[model samples]
Target chain A: MSNITNQSLSEILESIKSKKISSLELTQAYIKNIENAKKLNAFVTTTFDQALENAKKFDNKPNNEQLLSGVPLAVKDLFCTENVKTMAGSNILNNFVPSYESTVTKNLWNNGAFLLGKLNCDEFAMGSSNETSFFGNVINPIGDHLVPGGSSGGSSSALAADLTPATIGTDTGGSIRQPASFTGTVGLKPTYGLCSRWGIVAFASSLDQAGPMTKTVNDCSIMLEAMSGFDEKDSTSINKKKETYSKNLKDNIKGLKIGIPKEYRVDNMPKEIDELWEKGKKILKDLGAQLIDISLPHTKYALPTYYIVAPAEASSNLARYDGVRYGYRSQKGKDLIEMYENTRSEGFGDEVKRRILIGTYVLSSGYYDAYYLKAQKVRQLIKKDFDDSFTKVDAILTPSTPSSAFKIGEKTNDPVSMYLNDIFTVPVNLAGLPALSLPAGLDKQGYPLGLQLIGKALDEQKILNIGYAFEKNCGYKNEIKKWWS
Target chain B: MSLDKEKIKHVAKLARISVDEAKVDSLTKDLNSIFKFIEQLNELNTDKVEPLTSILNQSLRSRKDEISDGKIREKILKNSPKKNEEFFVVPKVIE
Candidate 1:
């Protein structure tokens, strides 16, 4: 049953329902692969023993009624799981285990999926490259030295490597979509409030959302249905009818209008990426979807705007970590104020601290109006750009990144350059819109390049349908060699 | 540059993260570069535009005044770095 570990989430569910494979057999295969793929550094914490126990329990009383149907999944460590250590790739929470489960993970468990382990991510989901993770960078399985696109890097790397069938990741300014693009997988960031934020370690509260990552678009649909819903506990969660995404996957898109945003064509973009965008447009056209050239005039300002808004919110959210209650407390403080200072200084990584300072500065007394409030006003204009464009197009199509995966340390020193990775994906988040990134094709060096479908807010179903049609006709099949094991 | 070592230090102090004296120079450089990039926002005039605190248009969600949850003190304190009985012990505040 080693091949079971290589199957899609939908395939695994079908196999289990047919009684062809037991949950134990499936979980064991994944556990064995995870043990051998230690070089990937994808997992921050392994729950193999607990996973086996749950699998055995499921095998004894298999229920085919659940959505996941006894599948095992590893998710980003940002989700707080009861009785398990949920570190947000920071030293501060290394010893802090949650006493409750996150709404998203709880939804997964209630759907019959058990935890496989916790995957690595950037510290508090801050960096574009997974390099900022305190657990260390998750190496892209595509190449030996490349950084898997990050914040949700471990989830992408592990999913692409077939270590887990389908996983979940949080997207705050492209954390989910960017990594999925680089890793040759499917990732979606639902509209701002599609999933609950409760029990997930807070990043930018307004922008942070958890969504599904998978090898195939259909599997992404299945996972999304199980993971999202309106929860009273999360005030931001949408209060609406539950979506049957997996049940509604359709390929016929005869008259769908897809906006091709002109501003996404940035200066000095790689030739291969331009060609990839062209190829994607042609594919969409051949699938009978009409393409319109549109402009999101505020595109260039989105990144700068995000840097201000995200960090401002992040600084406020992260102020909870002062070593008084949970997480790391420094041993070197003289008094109360010094203790708060010392704990934060030693506990957080450099990138985390950098953002905190930026946050603090922008929202500080004299700078608040010039920076934070100004960025927010500009953010409204950015959203208005999307709202106007949506009146003309059903969804917008763009490249997922300026380029494919880079070396781990290539842009770490220059924070601005690293931030440029999210240029194409950030605008969708700013508008509180749903977007999906699917592997469109491979780059010249064989790294996967992705095409994004940005839908109007609360229109995840539309993008998923569009993604399904494109994936079927694009003829892009990702082939990965078992190099890590 | 609006951000010098002094500005970074001041902000770090406000955020309660002690800046290592050695990192102030590099931190100033990084922060100044970010602020420089952020200056691009001024290129667009956003007069009369309301700062978007959230994309959702709904008013602040309110719930009825009623007890929804409580009595999980042990669970809450389970994560405290230093706890004694019913309270999380912090550094001497009165001293």
Candidate 2:
């Protein structure tokens, strides 16, 4: 049963084209899977009728050349969908439906991708585990009680559970990649501005980037092609000419130089993870790629610096959700100030409030120079570490997470422990580099371990090519099928 | 790096968030512990390092200052708490 679940997106598309199955039937199958796997809590909202109608439209359309035509995909609930409730996993947005669609969702639909549903997530994309979501936590597909990481936990779980062929997820500080690692799927966080952020419920505006979550690297490449482009409406959108991302998948990796960062292999890393890194190195070396030892010495400082910078930006971006304009308003308020305070206090989850407060403190006049400005300087040094390493290596490889998925509620009580889960993935975001997580091997507990590939900005194709080649060689895809059954 | 109850209250107010009196003591303890941990960054030698506001070193490209579709009245109003025919409604502040 898991065998069929592990089929690549390209194979599914071919099966649809040969009339072996219709898009409507495929959508129905996934929707049925979602219903059967309800205990996983992978989805926050399911659009059964809209998905069926869209699949029917795909059948009637004369053109079928689009790469993702008829593919059933789940969108993280953070993205706004027209007439559908986009909750961002918070009660404040429980009943709020945007009349306009997010640019990413609109692009997917325009490219013939069908929406399966909106997946669950951390409230406003704030937590490392799925536990903070207003909707109940999403469980890992492989183990019923284990966590699917967040804030894109639902997207990762859906892909892992065979509920969808692919999904769109937003990554601000490992929201996408960390969860993908937890669930043993492929997740990409393209260079910031590669994908338009217009209509995405803002979390940390400067750091947020959206990408695809799928069972294979090639599937992610195809989905990324459909999702990325320049947009006039988004101020941060890059103005580069559009190009096909999947075109470089078959490129040779024989001479590729992969860098192993000494700093990442720190004293605190578990022995199993260290062994996994060694295994990854051996595999790459066997493929005729050169391995070079490099140093990102500033790595330890990245986590602390990101906490300051991301929260500072988030504090400002989340300010728009006041009671008067939109979203939740407290009923007990007697005046405007009371209403504003009461609404946010009641509407936001504890983590969101914590971040807003931390952000406000760092950005305050007295401490701005000491905390926020200092963190920014460290951010530059962090980017330089990667920049200096890239000069010596064609690409960099690291474990996607410090360890595999932990059980739900294991670290929820301690925010610091939860933040450490993204320690390896955050620096890639801070540098605005393209990175992805590919299933490497299984840990002792049978949960999947993911190996990450980091590339120079706009060199996403290089990393995808390397990952696709690794997938072909490693063949972890077969093991995934067993979990589905 | 120790966050006192007074500091937590002041920060919450600056962020426009209201914390009940009972919660302030707990928040202070939590913030203090977190800040104490993060204060390890102070030990790093970053004297000459330049601050990076954005990873992209290039200047942002400016778009033409022409309005295309500046209005989405109906769509924007869909999430509004209180709205008249043409504008959102808020409490009057004028005396």
Candidate 3:
């Protein structure tokens, strides 16, 4: 079990298929790892009993053709797991257990994956750090006090610590990528409509996309292949045949033109991150992939534009939590209006409340055109910046974040400073393109640094291929002392 | 302050969240700084660009208006904090 916990998802699947290890054995190993790694606060709920039961059932009758038979995986709490507490790291939905399963999780289970548990995340997926969660902040497995990133912080932490073989995380604005970058794991935010969002708690409807967070590039590709497809329930879901992403991971990146956006060269970027970016470029160049200078001119405006668009949509989407249908309700309120207000004020965290207020203000009558619409127009320009650049290159390369994982309380107090964490990752979300973040090197502090590969919309296979080539060169792996144990 | 007290109060009301009077001062400051930060976007010339609501550039895929989903009334009601046999119980609204 000790040796098995260190194996990749692909290795686990192969081992299970060959009967070298039973699904129940693997499940128990992960459950033990999760039990031991509790200090990281990676999971909001651990469905160990249910996972073991499912694993036993699968072991009793092995399924040869199933993609990930009996593989234990965790999902970010934002994805609604049937009969499981889907808190989304908010007290409002702390007791809310969905009777339905999110489309992404359902797909994973359908492909013979067993659920380890629901992972912790930012409250309503709002903040850049896991500190905003109603549950306490998730500690990075790399360092004791450092954050594991957010809102998919728990997903990344668990994957990095080997608590789960693979996990699912949703990226609204760099949530998945940044955390993966910080934790030295692989995370992909697939194209906006590539995966269905049904049953996943809405953060920003237009920006939310679910993808796989895994221990390796091949595992990420395979998990994405299982989790993606069209569902009529999600109107935005694209109607396309499911792709075998793992089969398409051709390590030949030769003749591929990778674009390096000049806007990513910020004035105050840490030297280590810059050096890692350079190392990433050199790796690609050595592999025969041409690096070209490109400009995403509207990149500077992405953060502000995201702030407006995301919160505006969030305010509308969250309007349902009014002490009426589901979630927490105020007990002291005497009347309907008071009940609504009291329930929300008490249920929402500070960051959630702040964003909702901003959203409400911007979408309010006189300010709608000035703030919301203005931001949308700028969002178009940001999208155009990428659209134009894609014609010259096959994919874009950049650092995943400005820095590696920071201490828990470092940026929590400063909202503006915290928003800058998503500086490199947000523009990709704005343009609705697929991006993968994989470990390129370690920072001076010994925490992992990640480099990103941004692909043209629906070009996930291309980026994964390039990522596979780079991943081979770096030989980067998540190695941590048994601190939490 | 970028947004005055009345404006903050109005926004809070619009958002349906009651703000504590004590927190409003801090909330105002936070919103002000955020608004000021976002004001940087005003410098960008977006006069010719159309508002991009959806990034996919794909039009809404509408289907026949039919009852494709149902039979989950019990499941829907199960999540409500307070619910009767079929309906959720909320505070009285009628006079």
- The fnat scores of all predictions, in order, read 0.90, 0.58, 0.84
Question: What are the RMSDs of all candidates, in order?
Answer: 0.9, 1.9, 1.0
Total clashing pairs in model 1: 0
Docking class of 3: high
- lDDT per residue as tens, model 2, A1-485: 23343577888887778767778878888877888888888798999988999888888872468878887788899999988999999978887988889999899888878777999999999988888899989988878778999999999888888888889899999998999888889999999999999999998887899999988888899999998998877888888987787876774689899999988876678788888889888888888899999999989988998888888998998888788777888876767777788888888888898889989998998899888888988889989998998899989999999989998889977888889898999999889999989888888988888999999988999899888888877767524432433
Candidate 1 C-alpha RMSD relative to the actual structure:
0.9
Q: Give the CAPRI class of candidate 2.
A: medium
Tens digits of per-residue lDDT for model 1, A442-467: 88899999999999999999999999
Superposition error at A397 for model 1 (Å): 0.5
Clash-forming residue pairs, model 2: A1-A485, A2-A481, A2-A484, A2-A485, A3-A481
How are the candidates ranked when ordered by DockQ, highest leading? 1, 3, 2
The deviation in Å at residue A389 for candidate 3 is 0.5
Give the per-residue lDDT digits (tens) of candidate 2, residues B1-95. 67788888888877778898887877777677667766777988778988886777567778787777757887777788888988887666555
Per-residue error (Å), model 2, residue A34: 1.3
Candidates, DockQ: 0.86, 0.68, 0.85
Q: What is the Å distance of residue A211 in model 2 from its true position?
A: 0.9
Task: Give the worst 10-residue stretch by lDDT in candidate 1 chain A.
Answer: A1-10
